[model samples]
Target: DSFNAFMSLNERAARSALLDIQKALGPFRNERVLAATAVTDMAISSLQRRSVTIYLAPNITDMTVLRPLLTLFVQQVMDLLTREHNPDALPVYFLLDEFRQLKKMDEILNKLPYVAGYNIKMAFVVQDLKCIDEIYGETARHSLLGNCGLQLILGANDQVTAEYASRALGKRTIRYQSETRTLELFGRARRTRVEQIRERDLMMPQEVRQMREDKAILLVEGQRPILASKLRYHAIEPFKTAALASRQNTVPVPDVEMARALPVPATLPDYAVDGPDPRPGRIELDRHEVIDDAAFEASSAENVDAAVSSKERLVVTARKLKSVIAACLSAADMPMNQRISIQDVLAKTIPDPEEVGLD
Candidate 1:
């Protein structure tokens, strides 16, 4: 009846046909939709462990599921951090690979700079600087990367990214000596030498684009940039064993107690469209096993030396930030408008150092 409504009532029916229950429910009858809507044993607290928990990207066919999962995860994490103080609420790290592919990614990143106090840390992987700017807008890109404690560039072939890296890396003072010579017709040649100092890019855009695949560039906040070899996990013992061996095979595994190892999410069974819908949480949520925490616990890393460096880091950060602001003020394309003010952004986001005790 719903499908033929356009034919039955022509112009009148076209506007309201899709609003009917029968037409709306048709989309939910698909197996993929059913699986997404069905109940599952998901506990936000269960994911708050001291070890790694990897979330693999969803298949292309199941892409719609990613948005809810990500949003739910964020909401639950915020609630867990504020609403209830669980004893086991340790630091939670979100390692977001293919970061731009996720839906509402800006929501996650917008909250990043302030969430450190809640023990929330995130690492986002991006391929092209222009793409991020295009996808999330230039201001957001600036905000997200500017506050990062570390910026690691594995590879950059695009000119936009190379230029961005070249700028972000700052400059170095280079000194060189120049020689001038003139030949005399009657006798010997006379020569003069002069020395001068000038500033140049530490890494030029061309050099950044030509960087080797095995190497990486790291820009640590307040410290000098580092060019180092990338870690080869495949060549490492436990990594190689885990990748090639079966689930039951534990060869070459680390000697640490099994309880201390990272917790892995269990695979959920695919639900059929024809089957009755089951309430979510019918299955048990995954949790960490009891372990001896003191055996591997390291002493508090925050000491007087780190406290002294905190001021220096903030100073370096503020200098770079001023440069960024200056560039914005000069650039015609910095995207300032009546509704949006960078001044307000900086004022709100740049928290009081005294409040955080970093001062």
Candidate 2:
């Protein structure tokens, strides 16, 4: 249920993020083309000497729109990089801090190899190993992490994560001193210090905790592992600074409020009522109060096939009617109990169309 909720939240975030971007880039010709091509175009331009930075708050919960928007953005960057006209001198960086917020980490990681040719680099930062597991699942997380040329492990607090990191970093041995007692003759005892060297896997809990708290794991080209000393502080600053700088050069887009304030037609012409209401006021129909004489005969039969068949048909029709009524009630925002009552009514009334005046 937590996983489901997380996914639903992520999807909502993604949708809102895309909407925000669309609002910012207002009135583009060929809207579909604009949506599809904006990221690629921007990436190409960025590669040709422009810098691009997209920033969002850490706690932004809407990911429904965010994932697709980032996917498109990354795809565009990849497309620009892989194209034959890609300039070798210019390099583009797609930096995502706290990357677990987005849902496309695995897809993006899988495509990273292809983007290398375009001189496009990706940097992803997250707080812990478990974040990756939670966001991408275990298999994809492993695959994605493995493909990175560089793995920078900062501090980690969890024992499992630290152990994994310790093994990755390799191990060393150290010597320890201990007190030893020796009895020479029956009456003489001697105490001496003994030094011994022991080997153990490097799984320092303190170091891992420090790394998680203070260090930033930098994975470059998806291979070389390094503990990035400066990244912990500076990872976010560069993007923030870049965004601030761009604000001075950017032209302000018109506010949507002004557009909303424009007068709207009171009614839609197509839906305007032009004649007196056609709802029927009176109906003349023969009501047949039929008694089931055959029912008694059918019930008495040893096989009881007809009775079973009738019951089955009623059950099937009731199910179908209930589904239809449920759908309508759901759309109308009717409470569950009310919806159930409507379903009951439909099940009983719709079994014979003539009763509802439909025959």
Candidate 3:
């Protein structure tokens, strides 16, 4: 039974490799489960039988593609794990590196509690908290990171992320103050000592300097970096070597277009132009068509009288039909078609109606 399934044509080979590892492990014992990361091409169904699967999808700049794929992958993994139970099975450690490359990973992380019952542990490696916050927002970052048992942060350049990391690691405060002491002579010959209040703490200058220079910091179980190492001196060398090697002999391949041509229709149809002209010629109004002061005055007087008479009639009509409008709106027994007709009637009642133009 395969533990991990990858769902891509490009990742079929990698998926096979993961299945090989599962087969070699032979029923899951306490073995260091290290396999090359699975790409997105591998489908979830391929690894349905496997106890654990780690997906290593590429960093996609487009959220449209990345989000749905990751969401589907996480949901499928959770569903598969939840469906099966093996009390004697070995715990699955799911490692997701460059996790921020996936869109909305925080949503997937939020639901990880469901798989906790199946003894599935998840480790997400991201460049910084800012990356997570950018993809998942601040609220999600808090919830996702809070859920994790251990958080390992490497070199972080941003102050906001550093402050978050610092808070997570916890802090200790030390206070110091300077004061002047003086002796006061109250009476002619009596002198008493007068002392000013001061506070201080013991903090080594070298320790502060080291903290500033340290690039790597590990926070485990909400504990400070009791065992932190500088990446330059203590970290593994193979990773840097592999990254450099992978960059070499990487020549860009030119895109090749397929030779096949698409089929075309034999006959095309034409239609008459309608509505407003896209490019209308400018025209000047004739002198007779233009309005003069006498014509304007006569038109204004006629329009005003007609409008006043029409408004009075409209008010009376509105008063009479107010009950009908109210009845239509409140008609619970009205069918959908009738309600639509009533809505159309009300919509058509707007003043200065425009043509229902089509593109």
Q: What is the TM-score of candidate 2?
A: 0.48
Span of 10 residues, lowest total lDDT, candidate 1: 295-304
In order, what lDDT does every prediction score?
0.68, 0.61, 0.57
Q: What is candidate 1's CA lDDT for residue 37?
A: 52
Over the stretch 240-273, how does candidate 1's per-residue lDDT look in tens digits? 7776776567567566542233333343334323
Q: Which one wins on TM-score?
A: 1
Would you list the rank order by TM-score, best first? 1, 2, 3
RMSD of 2: 21.9
* Each prediction's number of clashing residue pairs: 2, 32, 11
Q: Give the per-residue lDDT digits (tens) of candidate 2, residues 81-153.
A: 5656555546767777868766554457667667666676787787777888886787877776666677776
Q: What is the TM-score of each candidate against the true structure?
A: 0.56, 0.48, 0.42
**Stronger candidate by TM-score (1 vs 3):** 1
| Model 2 global lDDT (CA atoms, 0 to 1) | 0.61
What shift in Å separates residue 188 of candidate 2 from its native position after superposition? 2.1
How many residue pairs clash in model 1? 2
Ranking by lDDT: 1, 2, 3
Runs in model 3 with CA error above 4 Å?
Answer: 1-67, 105-107, 173-179, 183-214, 222-224, 231-359
**Model 2 misses residue 40 by how many Å?**
11
